[model samples]
Target: MSSKAKLKAPVAAKKPVELIKHADVRVDPYFWLKERDSEEVLKYLQEENAYNEQMTEHTKVLQENLFQEMKGRIKEDDSSVPYKKNGYWYITRYEVGKNYPIYSRKKETLVTAEEIMFDCNVEAKGFEYFKMAGISVSPDNKLVAYGIDTVSRRNYTIRIKNLETGEIYPETIENTTGGCTWASDSKTLFYTRKDEETLRSDTVFRHQLGTPSTTDVEIYKEEDDTFNVFVYKTKSEKYIVIGSMSTLTSEYRILEADNPKGDFRVFQERIRGVEYGIAHYDTRFFILTNIDGATNFKLMETPEAHTESSYWKDLIPHREDTLIEDVDIFKEYLVISERNNGLNKINIKRWDGTEDYYLPFDNETYTAYVSTNPEFDTTILRYSYNSLITPNSVIDFDMKTKQKEVKKEQEVLDPNFSKDNYHSERVWATAKDGTKIPISLVYRKDLQRDGTNPLLQYGYGSYGSTIDPYFSSVRLSLLDRGFIYAIAHIRGSEYLGREWYEQGKLLQKMNTFTDFIDCSKYLIAEKYTSNQHLYAMGGSAGGLLMGAVMNMAPELYNGVVAAVPFVDVVTTMLDESIPLTTGEYDEWGNPNESEYYFYMKQYSPYDQVKPQQYPNILITTGYHDSQVQYWEPAKWVAKLRELKTDTNLLLFHTNMDAGHGGASGRFDALKEVAEEYAFLLDLEGIKG
Candidate 1:
């Protein structure tokens, strides 16, 4: 028998489950796959995994070569630019050959002896999958609290360590969001806990050092399932704030850091469709909000004594073209990160009204953002800058003198790699609605804009999250092999401003899919690539994009990759038990509502799958994913396998021991990337 015939695809049993809602009866044949722990489900997943292995067996050598090439470009013995916080110069460095970071701090001076805090390499020794997050140091600099997740499901266990004594305490807080805020007293901390079933961060608790987590006091509980709660200390270190936020509205409660046992007071009441963020500075709180129909957002401020919306006065009035993305408060200046004309800008304004200017940037398609500036009393404002061709550089700019220093630039160790060898540009593609969508592209300078060149287009146009054009060393594997990379700034993203995002969500969500299709057509029409040489990629919600585009315009691409894709929109949205469903109603709309139900069914990838010749495709998912459940893609692949007419490649990979983000090890994550790159390259007949 032929090798392809010997390795047959896994056929999932069709156990029809009728989902009735709003007078709509949708019959789901592979709904039984959601029963995660069932023996049948595990067996099917294993069979599919086995089949994927057999189908890709020919490319194992290429995958390994790609991994090594990518790994070689990274500087393994690297340390991040240390930023001072609370009298300590904190630094995170990685040792050569180590898979995790080593956190340490210096006393007062950068040259002082390094005091190692937590060596994640040592902490992650035995676990198959491990992740550590939210390492918070106490005000006194003696105690530290961090969260650890061994299961890869995102629910972390809070652990305390004595930095002075180098001893780990026995107390453990379970099922938390892996973040905590310290009170003035080093003995006390406030943290947010997640619900066991839905994994929603809905409750905040105050815990005392050396006490059992069971004795931790429940400070507040969010009764609304559609909102999530988090606890954090303001940059001013004056208040411990509890923030409750939904998609469209937010409310905050604050208590003085010195008053750990005192009752918290509400900062502001939540109003529907109003979203605001608070940044504390001295006796005043700066607010960034969409109040009074500031669609692109505006900045306001209120006295510390009067914490209400009525007390808010405009510090920077609403501008039609600018979206106030964020504000970083310092002792003498307010740094504003905003987006205008699809470009990122950092505006520095002096409190005394002496000077106000934006940091100059000349790149056509680049990303620049405020980096870590923990100290409130500094003239230097640190930020990072990068582009499709430029390596990432961390810079510190003096707000007073306007002088800048490049602290460090990413070191791509590949001897053949050079930024000058690549060219980057931004081009606009006309969408179906006559809207101009920007597409950022980078290719080797030697590349010709001919139809023979291969091109890979990527996008993530949901949740107003703008996927900026940034540098990547791993991408060299594709570019060096004669491939052009492009990022389509579709409407769902806030690339052009808040209005761009508004037009791409809710009932108008089809614009996102159609916008991507238009971008692909533009690239083809421009002769940068032909439909036979074009490929597409996206993960998470972008993975949803991949699925939708596959159904809408499969003929436009030669291959596609969907990583942990959210394909079963109608079913996942209707089930509130899912981790992030309830909180995302403002994003994908509530499918329980008849209008949204019918609207989602019209474009929902799984529901819209039809018998057609699909391009070569690969779908990746994690067994322990807390975000998009593994079954969405599993059932999606099952349905596609049953209905697809062509015998083109259809591969499904499940990271058995990982979750939404995939493998925890630094090198291990690269292996997944290497596999993805290999798949794309193999389809193009490229071999090392």
Candidate 2:
């Protein structure tokens, strides 16, 4: 044969090595369903507990080591300083200095090192229960009301704290409650609570301050499962409005202050769509809704002839492509925060429809929150803005004068902590079917992009959740250690809008798994990391994403961490007795339907795990997790162990006391993070 034709006949084209199909690598259906039974499930759960005990001890050690190393560098600084009427900022740092005062923005130099305002200590303890919850401040800023978990654990109690007196009044209530509104007199506070025992219904209750044992009377009650009740007071304090959610829509009922606890009649119902948010202006209720099929929304005003079926006037027409994130009614103006092009912008419009103004900022991320101020004409606008390389900076802006002053710039780390040390970049990847997805990455800039660096990819693509850019302290540990941290803004999230969410959920759930795989492939192709050093982590719905990705591309990751994952889709969906299963049908699709059942079974991680080479997986859940039951993860790990062909490590950990979130307090929270980080480090071959 000639030298050019020396290529041997492709070795008989290697008869396609009997590729195993998904159906070919299946498990016994009876073993998963009727045969194994609850007792077997319990046995698996016990195994999970045994594994968790070891992980917990290891995590404690890791945390102690980290704390010891960082103790010397941890500087004491004043935090959450409050502004006084005298225009002085009161601040307190228990570890460094005592209570102290600084000049206000109006009097102090913008760049001065000294003369800061309000010397108040950061109340870390009070934040344990309200870490991820909302807080309501009184109109006069004298009292603050926050929700705290009651003895029932599932239930929450609204507690009002006297800011000046340092006193707390906790009121007992049911589960799922928010929107605490203070009466014009400030003596009574109104809030909503869901009575899950009564078919998971919602009820509104009014509580008086300073009363601990007094049984609060329920003002209104709704039977529909979807009806969520919220209480809000008008800007003029003339009326208190109660809003209710129905199966396909929502309605609002208004009652005068004199009869706040009486049966409120519906003043507006289904004026536009099923979801409506009401904000009170000068004796008028401004309703925000998408009544005319416009995704963006319009502001409708309730005319004096307000009734259940009354038509509303289109006060603010729907602005194309602009969604109003939040709206606050100040004295003579309406401050609206609109999100456009992934950035928050504030627009102030005169109540009389005269003048409007837009404040410009260079950053892409900004949040403006209205601060309680006594002055009607002027409102204290507190905002924080940051970018990829910039640390957070808090500012106070005066609406009338358009005067902006930096209230507190987050203390940047020492010169040793250089932004150049860490690099953040955005990249796009093509999915299996040619869908392009965006992914954000953070890693050590000095690290070689030669597929040797350990990479941890995270994603949460569900529930209209937007995983936006924010600050994280623990991420610093990974960046400093030359580990690449990447977040895939996958489809199930509202990052790209509602359409993105619609495309990634239900029968199209496979899109999420495929998208994650694409991100991993892109990283490998770009020489960011090799499959041997890649790890994936997620929690809640994100946890489901982790499990699916691991099943779909086990060869692409060395290890996977799934916390409170909803893995057992078939089992969980079949059990309607669970707390959230019924309400989640709209998002996950009812598996009882034959079409949905078949489609879901296809991608359900717990059901899809086959006898194949699998990556090391560490699954964590909470025994008290009402959202995603502990059994889901337990069953998933047990089934995987029985079915997986490879002898890879599969560990399951369950928090016995905590709920969906594993920890409650600061130390506990830090410990959870430490454990997660340690697991990733171990997989990535990193040493403390």
Candidate 3:
């Protein structure tokens, strides 16, 4: 027998279950796959993995070649630009062949003796999955607290290191959100913890460095299931903030950063429909809020001492078209990150009352956002900018002199590479509803607008998450080939402003799916690509886009890739025990309500699966993923195999060790991308 025939795809056991919702009856035979970690489930997953390996064995060489090609373009022995924070220039670097970064710092100049604070390579020695997040140095610079997750779940354990003694404290805080705010005293730390079942960050705890985790005091607890909690120190270093936020509402409590035993007071009372963000500046609290029908969001200022909604005075009034994405405050100036006409723009306003203006971006489609402006008194504003054709760049703009310096642009080590060899532009793709969707695209400069090119169109149109056109060195492999890469700025994202996001979510959720299909159709109509050689890719919530588009317009593409997709929407949303289900009701709507139940089922990929032809598909998931459970994709694949009539290659690959994020190591994650690229290239008949 042939190797492919010898390794048959796993046939999941049929355990028919009826889901009657909104007066509709649906039978799911693979629902039993949700019994995660069971022996039978594990065996079935293993069989799927084996089958995937067998089916893609022909592309193993291509995968390895792609991996090496990507690796070759990276400057491995490289370090990030030093940014001064609390009397230290924090620098993170990677060695010749290390899979993790070495976090080090110099006291003064680059010539000073380097103090290796955290060698992630050494820390990740034995773990199959490891993530280091939320690294913060104490105010005194003598202690550093960091969060680590070895299980691939987002829950992290807080660990502290003494810079002077080079010793790790025995006390550890568990089930945290991978970050902690340190009191000015340095001994006290406050962190948020996840719920035991839902894994939502719902409680904040105060811990003294040497105390046992058991003795930690619960500082605050959010009672609302729709809300998640987080703790952070104000930019002015005056107060530590405990924030509770849901999809549509927000609340905040503030306590003096130096006073761990101090009482916390509400910054603003929570209103059912209002959403606001706070930043401390001088004696005023600057609020970015969506109050008073500011659909696109606006900036307001209120007294720091009396932070009530009534006390709020308009600073930057609501504009129907402009979206204030973020704000960065410094002693002499405030930098605003805004999106106008589907493009990012940075505005600088000096406290000295100088003329305010925006930093120039030459590219038609690019990403520009504030980066690492740590010092309160500094005149330099550090921001990051990148585009489809430009390398990621960090710029130090003198907010005073109006002069800018490119501090660093990513060193793509490939000798034959040049930005001039590629071209990037923006085009509007008209949606079915007459909405003009922005599409960012890049390809070889010499490429012709022919229908023969293999194209990958990507999107994530949910949760107001805008997918900016950012540079990727790994993407050069596709560009170097006869391929065009495009990002469809679809609805459900705040790309065009809040209204863009509003129109794509809730009852309008189908717009996100159709918007993507329309962009694909536009590309094909414009001769950039044809459906015969087109591909679709999205991950996490974006993975949902991939699933929906596959069902709605299966004939539009040749293959589709869904990464850790939230496919079983109706069932997952019905179960409030899932990590993100409750909080996402505002985004996807509460399925318990009949209004949303039917709407969600209409697009829920697993629920909508029919015995029809689907493009060749590759679904990836991490077994330990808390955000989108592994069984989602597992059950999805099983259902597809049982029902689909097409003979196209269908695959389900699960990383047994990882979670929401596929891999934690720097180089290890590239392997996943390499596999994805290999799959895309193989489908296009571009064999290595």
**Ranked candidates, highest TM-score first:** 1, 3, 2
Candidate 3 structure quality by residue, lDDT tens digits, 1-688: 2666566678899999998987889898988888988999999999999988889999999999999999999999988978998788999999999999999999978889999999999999889988899999999999999999999889899999999999999988888898999999989999999998999999999998888999999999999999999999998999999999999999999998978889999988899889999999889999999999987788899888899999999888888889999899998888889999888999888877766899988877788889987888898999999998889999998988889898899999999999999999999999998989999999999999979999999999999999999999999999998899999999999999999999999999999999999999999999999999999999998998998899889999999999999999999999998898899989999988998998888999999888999999999999999999999999999999998989788989999999998998888899999889998998998997
- Give lDDT: candidate 1, residue 306: 99
Point out the worst 10-residue segment of candidate 3 by lDDT.
1-10
Range of the 10 consecutive residues with the lowest summed lDDT in candidate 1: 1-10
lDDT of 3 at 687: 91
**What residue runs in model 3 are displaced by over 4 Å at the alpha carbon?**
1-7
Clashes of each: 0, 13, 0
lDDT of 1 at 502: 94
lDDT of 1 by residue, 262-351 (tens): 999999999999999998988999899999999999999999999999999999999999999999998889999999999999999999
Among the numbered candidates, top TM-score falls to 1
| Model 3 vs. true fold: TM | 0.98
- Looking at model 1, the pairs that clash are none
The C-alpha local distance difference test score for the whole of candidate 2 amounts to 0.65
- The weakest ten consecutive residues by lDDT in model 2 span 8-17
TM-score of each: 0.99, 0.79, 0.98
Model 1 ranges off by over 4 Å: none
Task: List candidate 2 stretches off by more than 4 Å.
Answer: 1-49, 52-63, 67-78, 81-146, 150-154, 158-179, 185-189, 196-201, 207-216, 234-238, 246-248, 270-273, 304-310, 350-376, 412-415
